[model samples]
Every structure is written in structure tokens, then in C-alpha cells.
Target: MDSTALDLGEDNSLLLVDDDEAFLRRLAKAMEKRGFAVETAGSVAAGQAIATGRPPAYAVVDLRLEDGNGLDVVETLRARRPESRIVVLTGYGAIATAVAAVKIGATDYLAKPADATDVTNALLARTDTLPPPPENPMSADRVRWEHIQRVYELCDRNVSETARRLSMHRRTLQRILAKRSPR
Candidate 1:
């Protein structure tokens, strides 16, 4: 969504879900400062419990959680609180994952390192609403994986070259591609 001006309410409550304790705490504090009542969960179970009981007006979910994948969290949120706007965040930021999040009823998907303003804006933009999740289509993960492999090949399997072309770091590119290859 465009980062246009928004009028956020003081009564709006936000649920921040992420495995990273520091990140979650920092985000909660920031959102609280922006007049949002914020609560945090470090695992999918805790998040689901809170969601089922008293859903917040907004949710910020991480792609990976210690208990399970964030997609499960999305499912739970949609089931219990369809009115709650949900935004998925990930450091990976793969296209396939982003598309999947949209398909699964997430209002928006954001990459990690996004600041409090970014998160606040996302929640505010979703005040309108969203549709329900559809039946599972073919996940784009395979296609994305293939594309990444092709890029790695084009870079002659060189992490530095691949990172340069991908506009990412050598280690980050290597880590992303390593899942497909053996250790």
C-alpha cells in the first residue's frame, strides 16, 4: 500500500508476533508510542491463543516462528478474527512467500528491518479490510527456488557474484541458496 497520510486511533490494539525477543519488544514500544496498545507473542501457540480469545485490531506476524511457520498464524488469525488486519514480515522477503501471504488473507507482507513507521503505516492502511483465504493453489516456492538456482548458475555458483546481481550480501545470498544444496 502507498504510504499516504493516515488517521490512527488510540484505541487500536496491535499484536506483534516474532521469535526475536528484541525485535518484538522494540516494535511493540514503537507502536505503543504511536498510540497503539501493543502485545507481543514469541511463539505461534501463544499468538494463536491470544488471537482466539481477544483478537487485536491489527497483527504483525513473522514468516518464521519457533513453534511453527507464520502461515499457520495467518490461518489462525483469519479464522478467529477476520477483522484484524494482518501483515507478514520476513527477513527473507522472497517473492513466492509474499504471494503466498497475500493468498492466505494477509493484508500485506513486509520485509524485516522495516521501522516502526513502516509497521504503523501497514496497520493503518489495512483499516479498510480484506477478503478470506482461498483454496491452496500451487505454492510459488518451487518456482522461486528454480529462479534462484538459475541466478546462482548465472553467477557461476559464486556467492559474491550472485550477491552483487541480487543486490544482497554474499553471505545472505549464500545462506538463501544453501537450503537447496547439501552442507
Candidate 2:
């Protein structure tokens, strides 16, 4: 444990949903320091359960989990607490998914490597004000690479299955998957 758990008064509660345990602990500690009483869940099921038991005023949800999509949790949370502020974080970001997240009640979408500061700002942002557009949006190649990587993971890293689903030659898919992601 990073630190002794503190009593989180209901008014200051927050829920963090992510599969990365280490990142969860670190973000929980950081959020605690920033005055949120943090509750964490490592899967969509756990997150939905937490929200059902007691919907927090705020949430930070990852886009993917070991068990299911984070969007499900977001939908549950929104249904449970319509006023809650929710931000979606993803290591694999796509414009389509980002738009879907907003439509599903997420207040903001952040591509990962987002830190506690970024999450905090997003969660606390005024709903009436629009956030500034990204100064450097992802290039088409980067987006395609990210999409392929996501689908590859979804296919359990099976090259043949992924290639089939992507309608690409197996060797071509393997070659692209093998290369480092573009900046």
C-alpha cells in the first residue's frame, strides 16, 4: 500500500476504474492529496458494483479493462449518478471512440500518459466551457497504428486471426505490428 487509507467523506468521493494496479495506486494517492476520497476498481464489473453501492461525485475510467470495455462502466455510472463528472483515459485513443465516450456521458477523453494533474483538471472543468482542441492531433498513420494495435490485443495477439479480421496479408499485419508505433 502506498499510504494508509483515509476516510473519504461522501461529498468528496471519487472512483477510479483502471486495470493497471500500479497506476491505480499512484493515481489514488495523488488524488487523495488533492482532496478526493478515492475508491478504485480494477475491472468493469468491480467498477459497476462500486457505482451501484454508492456513486461517487467524480470518476476516472480507463478505456479498456481485462474483463470488459470501460464504456459500460461509464454508462452505469451515468445512469446511477447523472451529475457525476467522468473522464475516459486510454492508452489506445481513437477519434471514433473519443466521440463515443462523450456521447455515452464522459465529460472528457484523455490519451494516456495522463497524470493526476490532467485527470484532476478534466474532472473539475466547467461543463459550460469547451476545452481547447488538441494543439497536435494524432496523424492518420498513428491513428491507424493505434487501431491495429487495439484490434490485435482484442484478438489476443493472434497474428492470423487479427490479419483475417483486418483483411490484410498475414505477413503484412505481422510486419506492421512488429514495428514501433509512429510518433
Candidate 3:
């Protein structure tokens, strides 16, 4: 089935909040083409501002932002529009965070590299069943690399801090970060 073909009607307004400027722009354009009135924000504060002014019917929020957690924006969106369908998108997806997001009112939690079709399905699904899992899931090494990268980012790209948090030697962390992500 073409998930993107699901028409949310003329009143289908959406807010997309992410720190990646290029990704945000592309996703906004894609969503607009798919029949949503799209508004974009690059931070939690900015998202909150737009949402407060006019709450969207749907929202796609990133888990990490320059200013704050996307959950903060999700909370505000839910407060403003109790019926809003919110989806939390994250590069650093974790079971704990996903559970927290759902508990706080998000309709779905998706990992990064999610396309417009995935977002639409997440926003409009009537059932709890998630989209089919990826055919080829990441290998253990690849997942470890991704997690290390996420931690590095969260630590403001500080090698020492990331190493300390991960309980690894600084040089080892540096070497891992320098290597290309595992396939």
C-alpha cells in the first residue's frame, strides 16, 4: 500500500522540528507535496513558538535538538492540541526514549533516515502495529558505532567527555570516531 497516498484532507497541517537544516527543508517540501500544510523549525524553542501560535494537526519532531529535547516540544504540542498526532524522529533511537515519548503523548517513534512515506504512515496510523522492520537490520558493530557517534554528539563532540561517559579510553574513542561507520 502507498502510505503517502493517505489523504489527511485540506486541514492537514504539520510541524517538522529538526536540527539538521538541509534535512528539515527537504522533509518539509516532501510533506507539502504530500498534502500537508507544513511548518519547519530548527530547535525546540522555535518549534514551541510556532506550535503555540497555531497548533498543528500533526508533528514530526527530532529527539535531540540544539536547544533542548524534542520531547519538550512534543509536550507543548500535546498541551496546545490534545488531538495532535505526534511522531518522534531520532538518530539516537533508544528503547527508553521511545517508551518515554509514547508515554508523554507521541503517536509513534521512528529512527533516522525515515522517509516521507514513513512519517505519513506514523502520523496517520489508526492501529498500534508499527511499519515492517527493516529487512536487513544493522550489525552489532554498526549499532555500536552508531551509539558511540550519538554519545559523541550529545557530549558536544568532546572526545574526553564521550570517552568518560562510555567508560572507554580517550584514544580508543577517538580512533573509533575517526573510522567510517560500520556497514
Candidate 4:
């Protein structure tokens, strides 16, 4: 380890981007201990700068940043390193955005409050296999409701657009969105 850079080398290089200073610093240390040579950025531009210079083998990027969307960072990294394993983290989870991330080369998408363990599992999981089923699956009704909510968010919460895409009447979609979802 270069006491200063803590760099292990290229194969294990990691980039972590998040506007949350505390979380970024914490994860950096945790990842370093796990054998990655970690580098971190707090905003999209900074993250892009580092990614452009040397796209790491792995990355963890927040979906929303103060300056711009973190998806932009993911795109930059993917463009620079096609084989890089990138994980997208978001406080607001939406199916549309998740699909967008995967389409653009993100290896995985995780909702906010993910721990080091969760991130590690996602980062290293085989891309070819399906993830194991949820320990406690959501009820069919709840699943339906969640899918509706995801589409609604993807449509920027525009009731008309969501209704149009869902092929349902505006009033019906509105009623579904308005109802409290089942826990």
C-alpha cells in the first residue's frame, strides 16, 4: 500500500461517488479494508474526471447528485471502461430508472441505505445468473401496487403519461396511486 494512495493496483481499483461526504468516506475505508484500491468523488464532475482518467474496475455511484444525475457518471465510467462493474444507488427506487441503468451498463441498482455487505454482494455477483428470490416476497397485490408506483415515478409522477403507458383510464390510475399501499 502506498501509505498515501492506499492503492493495491489496477485490478482492484474502485471508485465511489456520492454527495454524502460521510457515507463516501465511510465506504472508502470499508472497501479499502476489503482489498480494493479505492478512490472517491463527491459530485458528478469530480467523479467523471477520475473516471475519464482511469476508469476503475468497479464503481458505486449515487443516482442523484447536487450538480447533476449520477446516471451521467455511470455513463461516463461505462464509456471509459466497458467491463467495469458499476452499481447505482438511489434514494428513490424506480423500475424505469433501474432499466435505464442496466441499459447503459450499470451492473446493478440498489435502493438507498444499502450497507457495505449489500454493495459487496451486488458488486461481485455473477452477471449471468438471476439473483436469489427475496426472503419474504411481496404479496401479489403489493407487487402490483409497487409496479404501478414505479411507473408513476418513471413518468415524473405525471398521472396522464403513466395512465397512457399503463393503458388504463386516468381515473383508475389516479385511484391506484392515491390508495395506501399494503405493507
Top TM-score prediction, candidate number? 3
Model 3, residue pairs in steric clash: none
Please identify model 2 stretches exceeding 4 Å from their true place.
1-10, 91-100, 134-140
- In model 3, the runs with Cα more than 4 Å from the true position are 1-5, 153-160, 169-179
Tens-digit lDDT string for candidate 4 (69-156): 9999999998999989999998778899999999999999998667776777788788888767555666889767877888899899
lDDT (CA) per prediction: 0.79, 0.90, 0.90, 0.87
> Judged by lDDT relative to the true structure, which candidate is superior, 1 or 3?
3
Model 1 lDDT, full chain set: 0.79
Error of 4 at 91 (Å): 0.6
**Rank by lDDT (best first):** 3, 2, 4, 1
Q: How many residue pairs clash (N, CA or C atoms closer than 3 angstroms) in each of the candidate models, in the order given?
A: 0, 0, 0, 0
- The parts of candidate 1 lying over 4 Å away from their true place are 1-11, 126-183
User: Can you write out model 3's per-residue Cα lDDT over 53-112, one digit (the tens) per residue?
Assistant: 999999999999999999999999999999999999999788999999999999999999
Task: Report how far residue 182 has shifted in candidate 1, in Å.
Answer: 28
